[model samples]
Every structure is written in C-alpha cells, then in structure tokens.
Target: MRRVYSIVVSAGLAPALILGACLVLAVSPTLVPAELAGLVRYGPFLLALLGGVIGWWFNRGRAVFVMALLLICYWLLVGNGAGISAEGLAFLQIATLYLVPLNLLFLGFTAERGVLNPRGIARMLILGLQIFVMLMLAGQPDVGSALYRVLETRFFASTGVLGTMPHPAMIISAIAVVLLLIRHKPLETSFAAAIIAIDAATVMGAGVIQYGYLAATGVVLAGLAQEAWRMAFVDDLTGLPGRRALGHAMAELGNQYAIAMLDVDHFKKFNDTYGHDVGDIVLKKVARELARVGGGGKAYRYGGEEFAVLFAGRTAERAQEPLDALRQRIADNKITPPEKSKPVSVTISVGVCERDEDTTDPWAVLKSADQKLYRAKQSGRNRVVI
Candidate 1:
C-alpha cells in the first residue's frame, strides 16, 4: 500500500488528474451547460475565493488570509487599476504573474500543517507587494526592453526571455524548485512549481495564469483530504500507519498471512529519564526501521510504543527471520536525544502469529500475536516469540 502511494505521488497523479479536468474545459467549453460555462468563466474567481474562506473556517484560517493577500496582489498586478486597459499591454512583461502563486507555494511549504502562518504570510505579501511595485516601475525602463538582454540578443534568442534584469520570475521558479525539493512535502510543492513553470511558458494567455492558481488550489484540496486521512489513520508519533489503517489493510489481505506484535523495551524509562519528546523520537526511529523489515512486511504503530508488522501470504516460519532481524536492528540502533550528547539504545520484543485454517478472523490472529508478545516481554524482552 505504501509502495503504491509512493508510486502515485512520484508519478504526479494529483496534478495529472487536475490537469485532465482543466483540459476538458479548455477543449470542450461548450460541453458545460450555459450556466456552468458562465460559472467556469465568472464563477472561478468567486469559487476560489470561497475555497479560501472555507479553508479559514476549517481551522486552516491562516491559509485563507494568505489566499486573500495573493488574490489582492494578483488583482493589483492584472486588474484594470490604472485606467489603462491591461489587455493593451504586451504580455512579455506579464511574466510577473508567477510571483503570487510562487509566493504562496513557498509560504505554504513553510506553514504549519501546510497552512501559511500570518507572520510569514504577511512578510511574503509585503515582499510580493514591493516586488509588484518594482515591476510596475520597470514597466518602461528604457534602461532595457528586458533584463538579461544578452539572453535574447546573444544566447537562446528563439524561445526568448521575460521581464527585466534580475529576472524575478526565473529566480523565484528556481528557488521554488529547490525549496520544494528540500521540504517535507516535496511532491506537492514540486507539482505546484511544475505548474508554475508551464504557466511561465504560456504567460501570454492571462487565462493560463488563473489555471495555475486553480491547479495550486487543487493541490491544497488534495492536501486537506490527505491530512484528514492521516489524522485518522496514521500514527502521529511514529509516522507509521495506525490501527485504523491496519484494519483496512487486513480487510484486503489473503487468508495466508502472519502478523507480529512488537513493543519497545524499557520505553517508560525514556519518558521518565528524558521526556515524551525523546520517547517520540525513539518510536519514530523504531518505526522507520520496522518499515524496512524483510519478508515484505508492512509496519503500523499500534498505539503507545507498540507496533504491528503484517506479512500477508507469509507464514510464521517465513516471517521469523525478518521479525528477529527487526528485533536485532532496534537493539543495535542508538537513539540520540535532542540537546543531549549521550546516545542511548532501546530494544523490542516481538510475537509472531499465523492464520490457521480454523481461524477466520484476522483480529483473532492479531490477538494471538498480542498474547505471545506479552509472553516474550515477560520472558526477558528483546527476542521474538512465535
């Protein structure tokens, strides 16, 4: 299941789906009902604004404010503000539209829970506002028709360049990609950055920039859904699948399977000696190792220093080597506490159980593993009992 998730995310599935939706509109604008088509054209702004509002109400209120700022910045740049029709201006300078979304993406990646915070968002907005003002000033800089005129004059002249010297759009694009690659949620960030790149290439069509915003919004929506799923089914401390996800996994498993219950040895000592913070670090490290256990096992955090590893289509005999190796690995890894130089190590005791012909319930098999886990813990922890 995790492999499938990695594959889908790496393949850019979310943006692909949104891109498909956008293409349908671009291709068959008539396919939509008259009312819907009008909504598509006129309602997008309102709908996107509404989404920002909804985000605020959903405790992602911070993002709504950022969205509002971004919307205002975009409108200021693209809207009919100076009595001079924006339509009349050559789009060569319009590459400036990339800033707002790029700003949001960078801010979003830095935001807590993926929602841009007020202080950070404010700074970005202020900076973005200043940049927009600068662009407006650079509008007729006979200083040059473009920044890096050498790129057009001497370098790749066919594809050409946009904006003036110190090309902010290209700079932001490079910075966005680098930042996204380093951030925790690289896939989503990179997806938004990729969309921005495509938007940069088609900046002439003003409408394309809006599509880029919509695509960013789509990523935000998908992120919300993924967060909801994580809160319910992923263990916060260990970053592993939780009990709810374990139940779902078992539901899809074949009858032939082995399950193991693991408990961190002397986990209470960590909390007593250091704090839950250190305990959390231990759990996360332990889960990380368990996730890579051999024999095609899947790991889950089964609440409070305890973990579960399920090996579908594998018997207890086949699962033993991996379970024991997992035990040995946990025993060997030294966990370093934050702000402390001394490294400490912990171990785990595991109990493995296989589904029998008479046992139809996977939970019952899990219970068997649980019982054996207790026995292993009782008989001097750090070994696997099957």
Candidate 2:
C-alpha cells in the first residue's frame, strides 16, 4: 500500500489527471458555458504566461524557457491576429509542431542554472533566433514553399488513430515521448504528456487544438507546483522528509504515538575531521538505515545531523525494539571516506517519548524526546533511551 501511494504521488499522476480532465472538457464542449467560450481560444496563452512567472519565481530555467517558447508558438499559430495567408499559416503550424517537441527534448537534458544567468540568456537568444528565422520563412513565399514541401513530405504510410498527424512530426514527437519517459521525473513525465496532447491535437482537428494546448500548459504548470511543494517539504541530501514535514506530521499525531529524536554521535567533530562532503555521505547512510525501521515508523530529517521518527499508533514501550534495532543497524554500518583505507564508524543517540497525560501536546512530547536524546548522548553515546 505504501509503495502504491509513493508511485501515485511521484509518477506525475497529478499532471496525468489534469490531462484527463482537459480531454473530457475538450470532447464535451457543451459542458463549457457559452459565456466563457472565448477561454478556449485564449486560455493557453494566459496559462503559458502564468507558468513563465511561476518558473521564474522558482528559478526553474527549463520551465521558464519552455513556457516562453510555447507562448511564442501559440501566438504565431493562433493569437497573432495577423490575417496571415493560408500557406503561411500552414508553414507556421508545421514549424511549431516540429519546434516545440525538439525544444522540449533539448531542455529536458539541459541543466537548471536559473533564469537570469548567462546560460539562460543564451538560451533565450537562441529561441529568439529561431522565432526570427520562422518569421522570415513565413514572410517569403518562395522559401516558405520550399521548406513546407520538406516538412510535409510523408516518410512512411500513415494509418491508425494517429494517421492524421504529419509523418515527420509524428516521428519527432514519438522520439521525444520515449526519451521523456526514460527520464521519468515528474517534470519530464508532464512534458511527455504535453507532447502526446499536441500530437493528438494535430489529428483531432482545429476545434479541439486549443484544448490540447490548454492541457499541455496546464499539466506543466501543475508539475511546477508539485516540484515547488517537494522542495519546501523534502530534504535534498538525504531524501527524507524535512523538519517542516515532521512538524506537519506531528500536528495530526494520535494519542498512542511515540516520537523519537536522534542525533549523530560526535557529528560536529567527525565533520571537522573528515570534511563536509564525507559528512554528507555519513548522514545519508544513517538516514537509509533509519528509513528501513520497522513498526510503522516514518523517519524525517530534523535539521542538520538530528533526525526524528514517528510511530503513529505505538507507545515508547511498543516502539523500543525497532528503535534499538535501528540504532544497532546504523552502528554496524561503516563508511569509507575518500583517501581512507580504514572504514570509519558512524553511530547515533536516540531519545524516545510517547504521548501521556503529562505530555499530551505533540510539541511537548517532542521536547521530552529531545531531552532524552541528550541523556543518551551524555550516557556514553550510541544508545537509545526511552
């Protein structure tokens, strides 16, 4: 059940759900109010702008670039109001179909260096160059005609559900989807869904194209929101829930819950001797052992070398065996730092307290556990005190 929950939350299900809802609304246009019908035409552009602002705020370079690129593509394809010739419009459509997925592929592999750096400015310049080239092609009948021929040429026979999509564009989109799946991070999963929606729009006709773009933009935006939430609540180094998450969890604790506070033995001294890099490795190793604790325990990083575990329905007495085992497992493990032939040992001191008449408040229980942890450290570390 826990594994299933993790998969549901981590596998980009939020974006997938958003895509499903958008598809439903797209197919049942009558479900949309007649007064708000114009939203279908303008909503994607608005969403792209909002997404760009969010990306910039989060310092997610890929989101900023992709959103800007998508906004430009949408403008040229639908919102320009330029009264472009039919041939020019066709050329722009083909160009956008190819460009969007290609850029998604490139940006997926690109590192996030924030939105205002030199690399980011270079990315923007490249996008501007592409936009300029696209406009030049659209304005020149002869050049646009030559490029359109190449873009429209079918490389293979089209059939089945996606037959309406151009062959070259379909191939590019498929490759991008496959690569994004291989990456399989939340943002990449969202990008894969967006590419699939764009391809479906090509096949489903113009009436639903706006809905497709809406789904694409909406899913990516949702993904950014999820990433931001994770950054707020999850510890980056140890992959454990952070102190903030621990506080949230404690707020809803049951009457029989036990809270265990743990601190690395001699961590400051060890860090100074072995350096911070090796110190991080030791913390991660300790976290891994703590995460495997039985008795329904949920481990969290409670700032620096301090950690916590909550056993929701268990008292300190009930939680003792597993806590002791966790302590022993961590003590048994050895970490070999770089340039060291002998492996160094790492251990922790734990203090546990359960909810009782005198300590009904969760914070009070946590403080008692922290005080016990200090006792364990003073009583010749590498032990558990309850």
User: Best by TM-score, which number?
Assistant: 2
lDDT of all predictions, in order shown?
Answer: 0.65, 0.85
With candidate 2 superimposed using the best TM-score fit, by how many Å does residue 293's alpha carbon deviate from the native? 2.2
* Model 2 bad stretches (over 4 Å): 1-11, 80-85
Tens-place lDDT per residue, model 2, 1-386, is: 43344445564687778778878887898999998889878888999999999999999888888888878887776756374566666788888889999999988787778889999888889999998888877777777777888888786676775567678888899999999889977778778888887777777777788888888888788767767767788898998989888888888787789999998999998789999999999999998998898999999999999999999999999898999999999889888899999999889999999999988999899899999999998999999999
Q: Candidate 1: where is the Cα deviation over 4 Å?
A: 1-11, 20-36, 61-66, 69-98, 113-166, 184-198, 201-204, 338-342
lDDT of 2: 0.85
> Clash pairs of candidate 2?
none
lDDT of 1 at 253: 81
Candidate 1's error at 139, in angstroms? 15
| Candidate maximizing lDDT | 2
lDDT for 149 (candidate 1): 45
